[model samples]
Target: MTESDGERRPAGELEASVLAALWSAGNPMSAAQVRAAIPQPLARTTVATLLIRLHEKGVVGRSPAARGFLYFPVADSHGLTARRMHQELDQDHDRSTVLARFVEGLGPDDEAELRRLLEGGGQ
Candidate 1:
């Protein structure tokens, strides 16, 4: 959905957009730069707030800039996905069940790839 719809978006969606802008940039960007890069017409302050929140979450890192700060993702997309997976796993007490169900849900190709990785074949 577009921000023009005047609907409140989930914080995660906003954060993901901010991250996409940063990743595309491949360099630290100021809030204004991020705002311009994103498809959504968010205010500079809103972009800055999202960057600050991402920094707090360890998803992004920042450096002092002449105006405010330049934000960049701490990891690439795949690394972030892995980190999220780990976070989800860490939250559940029944890790074995969670992992089992996760493996069960995988398609054949993904299952083979996972098995290969598990057997240290990918290394």
Candidate 2:
């Protein structure tokens, strides 16, 4: 659906939506710009506040712009996913067990890719 014609997303979906918009823009954007990129109608203030929250979470960076700030993602989607995975891994006491479980759950393709990376194969 277009930005002007979509149902209100559920809780926590807003952050993901906002982040996706930032990633797609490929540059810092003001709250107004972000609102425009989003697929749902969102208030300027709402976007501003969401950006601020993301900034606090270290997911986004902001700098002084015209009147407020231009916000950008601190990491791309892959980097963010890796960071989150590492964060979760760090939370557990049994690191080996956690990693083993994770490895065990990987599909064949992902398992092969992981092995290749472990073996220092760039391709």
Candidate 3:
């Protein structure tokens, strides 16, 4: 979906939170432990489902444990955000169209500033 047209999905929230919890923990944690980190009382099965979703998204890693899967975030939030940003930029098909739309939307002063930056006049 286009960035403007795409609304946030429940799966996205769950995925983000699972990553956050793992980031805060800084270690692999069991499903129950991850669920406890979440604000709400989530069923272990629910967290497991979210974990699976994250794993599919390439944002989390899983390992087998005695009682259940141990989960960890594959990267920190900033790294993940950078990946998403890179994906969005890479997905744009027409480079000229992207630049045209970007410049067209800028105000006069902003446009001038961007020009200067592109010309290596601004640091």
TM-score per candidate, chains pooled: 0.87, 0.85, 0.67
Model 1 Cα shift for residue 119 (angstroms): 1.6
Give the C-alpha lDDT of model 2: 0.92
Q: Where in model 3 is the C-alpha error above 4 Å?
A: 1-9, 95-123
lDDT of 1 by residue, 23-95 (tens): 9999999999999999888887888889988999999999999999999999999999999999999999999
Q: How many residue pairs clash in each candidate at the backbone level? A: 0, 0, 0
Q: Write the per-residue lDDT of candidate 3 for residues 13-91, one digit (tens) a residue.
A: 7777777789999899988898999875567899888888888888888899998789888888888987886677688
User: Best to worst by TM-score, what's the order?
Assistant: 1, 2, 3
Among all windows of 10 consecutive residues in model 1, the one with the lowest summed lDDT is: 1-10
For lDDT, candidate 1 versus 3, the one ahead is 1
Q: Cα lDDT for residue 46, model 3? A: 90
Candidate 3 has its poorest 10 consecutive residues by lDDT at 4-13
**Candidate 3: pairs in clash:** none
Query: lDDT tens digits, residues 7-110, model 2?
Result: 56664799998999999999999999999999867788888889999999899999999789999999998999998999999999999999999999999999
Off by over 4 Å in 1: 1-5
Which 10 residues in a row give candidate 2 its minimum summed lDDT?
3-12
Model 3 error, position 24 (Å): 0.7
Error of model 2, residue 74, in angstroms: 1.1
Error of 1 at 43 (Å): 1.0
